[model samples]
Target: MVVRRRAAPPERCRPSPYGLRPGWDWTARAADAFGRAWHLADRYPYRGTEFDSSFVGIFRVDAADLFSAAPDLVNPAWAEATGQQLQDMVPSYDFHRLEQLPQVLVEAARESGALPAVRDGQMRTARVCGLRAWLHGYRRDQAGSLIPVDAVRWDGGVHHALSVTDDSTDAELAAAARRAEQDAAARGIKLIGASRWVEQLRAARRTAVREQLAGLRDEIAALEDRLKPARKRRTVLVTRILGWDGERDTDTALGRDAGLSHTAVRTLRTALEADQEDRGGEEGGPLAGLFR
Candidate 1:
C-alpha cells in the first residue's frame, strides 16, 4: 500500500473575519495543542471565545435580523454566535448609531480596557437603539486585503442594519455582501410576531384545500367516464313517468308498470314518432325509431 502525506494548513495568526474570537491563539502552536480545543461558549459545539459568548448571551438578536443578514450562513447551532455578531449595535458611550459614533466613544472603545477591539476597532456593532443594523466584519476586497467592519445600512443617519462575516476569500466576501443587500431589501416587512406566522399558515392551508378540491373534481370526472359502459348496458325496470293510461296508449302498459300517468305514455309515443320522421328509419311501428 502507498500513502501520500497531507500538508498542514498555514498557521492562522488571525481568525476568519467574524465576531467570535478564540481564548488563545494556541498553547504551543503544535499539532498536539489540546488546550486550543477547550472553552465555555453560549451555544453548544461552543465556538468563538468567552467574550463572544457573553456578548451574544447579553443581547438577544431577533431571528429575522440573522436571517436577513446572511441566511445561508445560519445553522441551528450557529445562530447564537452569528446573531450576536450580526445584531445592530446597542446604545454605547455617546453614539445613537455606530455610523455616527462620536469620536469620544470610538476613542473610548479603542482606548478603554472594558471593550474588546479587533486590530483597530471595537469588536461589536455600533449602537443605535431601536434601529435595524447590519455588520460585515473585516472582509477582503477584489484586491485581496482586509476591509474592516462598517455598518452598510448606516446611510448617513437613521440607524438600520444587518451583519455578515466579511473575513473570507475575496469572492466569498463579495458574494456575502451581495446576498446581504438583496435579502435586506426583499425581506423588509417585519414578519416576526405570532400573528404574522399564523397568517402565513392560514394562507398555506387555504391553498392546500383549493388544490385538494380540484383533485377531487378530477377524480369524480374520471369515475364518471368509467361508468359510461355500465350505464349503456343497464336498463330501468319500471322507472316512473307522469300522465299515463294503459288502456289508451301502447306505451300505457309500460307507463302503468312504471307508475307513469296516461299523458306521459302518449308523450313518449309522440316523441318516438317524431324521432322516426327525423331519422327516416322505420315507416311506423310500436318500436319505431329505436335505433332503427
Candidate 2:
C-alpha cells in the first residue's frame, strides 16, 4: 500500500500595489516627513525650501498619512533633515490639504509609476477621512513629465427619504380578516367557528379509547387460552405409563413414566394445582375441595 502525503499549509503573501513595505517606523517616518513639510510650507522663507522640507517630512510621517500635513518645526533638526529627505521623498508626497492625504498620496504613487495602476472604475469605494476630492495627476522627478491617474467620484452625503402610502380596499380587508382567522386556528387559538372543531376533537378521542379497550380484551383472551392445560394429552400419557407391562419401576413415575423431563413434569403439576385452586374459589362451596 502507498502512503499518502499531507499538503503543506499555505504561506502568507503580501498585498499587491507593493511600494515600500510599511511598518510602524515607516509610517511614523512618512507622517513626520509629511507633517514637517506642511509646517515648513508655513514657516520656511521660500516656496522651494518649504516644498523640499515637505518631502523630508514625508519620510518622518506615517505612510498612512503620507500626503497629510507636515510635522511642526518645533525641532530644527527635523526640519533640516526634511529638506534633504525631500530630495528623494518628493515623489512619495501626494499633497492632501487637510483630509484625503493618504488617498491623494496613493493616487499620486499610482500615477507617478511608483506603484502599479489598478483597473478602471476601481478604487471607487476607497475612502479617506477629511478628503474632499481625488487628485487626477502628479509631477515626478521634476522632469515636467506628468502622469495622469483616474479621479474617484465622491458622494459622501446625499440622502433620498422614502414615505409610506396606505391603499386598502374592501375586498383586501375581507381577505385579510379570513387570513387572520386561519392563522389563529394554526396557532391553537380559538377561531370564530371553533365549537364544531371542539366537538370533532372530543369524538376522535372517544374513538381512540374504545379501540384501545378492544385491543386489551383480545390480548387477555389470548393469554387465557395459552394458560389452559392439554387434558387429553395428559390423560393419555398417564394411562399409558401406568398400564405399561415393563418391569422397570421408573415407568410408574410421573415424569419418566410419561416420557418427559422432571422439570416439565413439575411445571405441569404446578399449573394444574393453580387451576384447581382457582376453580375451588369460583365454586364457593365445600364440594370444590373434592375437585382440588
Candidate 3:
C-alpha cells in the first residue's frame, strides 16, 4: 500500500514580448539601442540602483512611451533618445513589459531637475510612485520572488510600528515615575533624598521589567523548541499514516522538519533509539522503528 508522489513539474519560461521572436533581426537593434541608452544613463548624475544597457531592452520602450505622453514633464534628451532606440529595436513591444520604464524615467527626471519638490514631498512621491511600481511589477513575476518582498515589507512595517509603540510605552512609564516622585515629595520627606528615592524606584521597576522580558524571551524560545519536535513527529506520523513509498526514516523526517543536516538527524535518531531501548519497549513497534 505504498503511495507514490507526483514528480515535480518542469519550470516554465517567463513570457517576454521583447524577447527573441522567430525571423526577427531585433536582437542587434535591441543590443545597440540598449548600449547607447545605458551609457547615456550611466553618465547622468542620478543615484540608486545601477541599471545599464543590459536592462535597456527591458525598460527603454516604456520610457519612450512616457516621453511621448508627457514630453514636457520628463525632458531628458538622452531618455527620449533611449526610448526611440528601444522602439526602433522592438517595434511591437508589450505595454505590460514597459511598466518599469515610467518609474525609471521619473527617477531620472527628478535627478535631472526636471521634477522639483521639497525633500519630504520628493520622498513621499518616490515611495508612492517608484516603490509602488516596483512592487506591482515584482508581484506579477512569480510567487517565490514575491515571498521575500512580503517578508521584508512585513518585517519593516512591524519593526517601525514596534518602535513607535515602545516609545509611547516608555513615555507612559516615565510619567508614572514623575507622579510617584511628586506624591513622595508632598509628604514633606527631604527633597534631597528625592534623587536617591527615584533611583531606587526605577531600579525596582527595571528589575521587574527585566524579569518579565526574560520570561517572554524564554517562552518564545521554548515554543520554538517544541515546534521542532512537533513538526518532526508530524512528518513521521503523516508519512506512516499515508503509507508513503520508499523507506521511512525518522532521522530524515526530523532533519527536514528541524532544518538540520541529515547526518545530525541520523545521530539524533540513534541517540533516541538508545534511550528508548534502555526503557525496555518492544524493539519493532511503531515508535521503535521510528527512532531506528
Q: By lDDT, who's the top model here?
A: 3
Better of 1 and 2 by TM-score: 1
Per-prediction TM-score to the true structure, in the order listed: 0.27, 0.17, 0.22
Count of clashing residue pairs in every prediction? 17, 28, 0
Candidate 1 regions off by >4 Å?
1-191, 234-270, 277-292
For each of the candidates, the C-alpha root-mean-square deviation to the true structure, in angstroms, is 20.3, 28.6, 26.4
Q: How accurate is candidate 3 locally (lDDT)?
A: 0.41
Candidate 2, residues 180-234, lDDT tens digits: the string is 4444545443233222223333455567778999999999989878755554456
Model 3 C-alpha lDDT per residue in residues 1-292, reported as the tens digit of each score:
3333344335243222334333322222353455556456544443333421223222222333353554463423222122123334333322332233456656675676544444355322211112222223333332232222221122223322222222245555445434543443344321122223334444666677789999999999999998987777754654353233335545566457657677865655555455445756555534455544
- Mind sharing the TM-score for model 1? 0.27
Backbone clash pairs for candidate 3 read: none
Candidate 3 lands at a TM-score of 0.22
| Weakest ten-residue segment in model 3 by summed lDDT | 125-134
lDDT of 1 by residue, 136-191 (tens): 22111111332222222223211111222222344544444455434433544111
lDDT of each: 0.36, 0.36, 0.41
What lDDT is reached at residue 59 by model 2?
15
